[model samples]
Target: MQSDIDPRSLIGRKAFDRDGTKIGTVDEVYLDDATGEPEWAAVRTGLFGRDAFVPLAPSRVEGDALNVPFERALIRNAPDLGVGGHISPEQELQLYRHYGLPLPGPAPDAPGSGEAPGSSGSAA
Candidate 1:
């Protein structure tokens, strides 16, 4: 469910897990290259403030905060791909696998069965 809130507006918002445990502050939001949809968020966590990428599929923007359904521990261990960089497809796959979440994007349910629509399979 996409919230009316712009992902950019989510920056600096505090994020909490389903258990109401404060996870961290949203440092950045990553959008899908194809759809331009908010796909992942880089949350500043840990004592030294590390940025970890968390999937936004199960997250909701509530007022000034983002509510994620995952546990605090899980989010704390999420892959740290840093902030302000292009996330390669391989990196995206790693993130999804790390969280045990089905890979999202074109034909996410079928795993290796699909390519980005209208992006390929054409002859030059």
Candidate 2:
């Protein structure tokens, strides 16, 4: 996500999957409570379709569209956390797990380690 772009601008923009498959239009933008950064977008898949949340970090905005680096089927099947209001930490963690993406915060097992639990803290 472009840091300069206003999160509100993402609303209503068309979103596409990795292979250019049309997924939906962004209905809402979820921001990180800690950093105020754009975190996820709830996209309405179709007319009367349920909103699906897509992470904003790995997604990009091109023209009037959002390009999500994920498969259409996977995104469409994401956990239905509903739209509006706040997303609790537990819900956020679930979203990360659903997308197989890294957690934004430090590893819980090793506080301040800034690395996932099985990492050696050295370059491979």
Number of the top-ranking candidate, with lDDT as the measure: 2
User: What is the C-alpha RMSD, rounded to one decimal, of candidate 1?
Assistant: 6.4
The C-alpha stretches of model 2 lying farther than 4 A from their native spots are 106-124
Clashing pairs in model 1, backbone N/Cα/C closer than 3 A: none
lDDT of 1 at 73: 88
Q: Which digits, one per residue and each the tens of the lDDT, describe model 1 over residues 1-124?
A: 3756677888899999889898889888887765566778888885687987777887888778889888888888877776777787767777787778875546646544566322111111
RMSD value for candidate 2: 7.5
Q: Write the per-residue lDDT of candidate 2 for residues 1-124, one digit (tens) a residue.
A: 8899898898889999999999999988877654577888999999989999898889999999999999999999999987776777667777888999987654357455563322111100
lDDT of candidate 1? 0.74
| Candidate 1 TM-score to native | 0.81
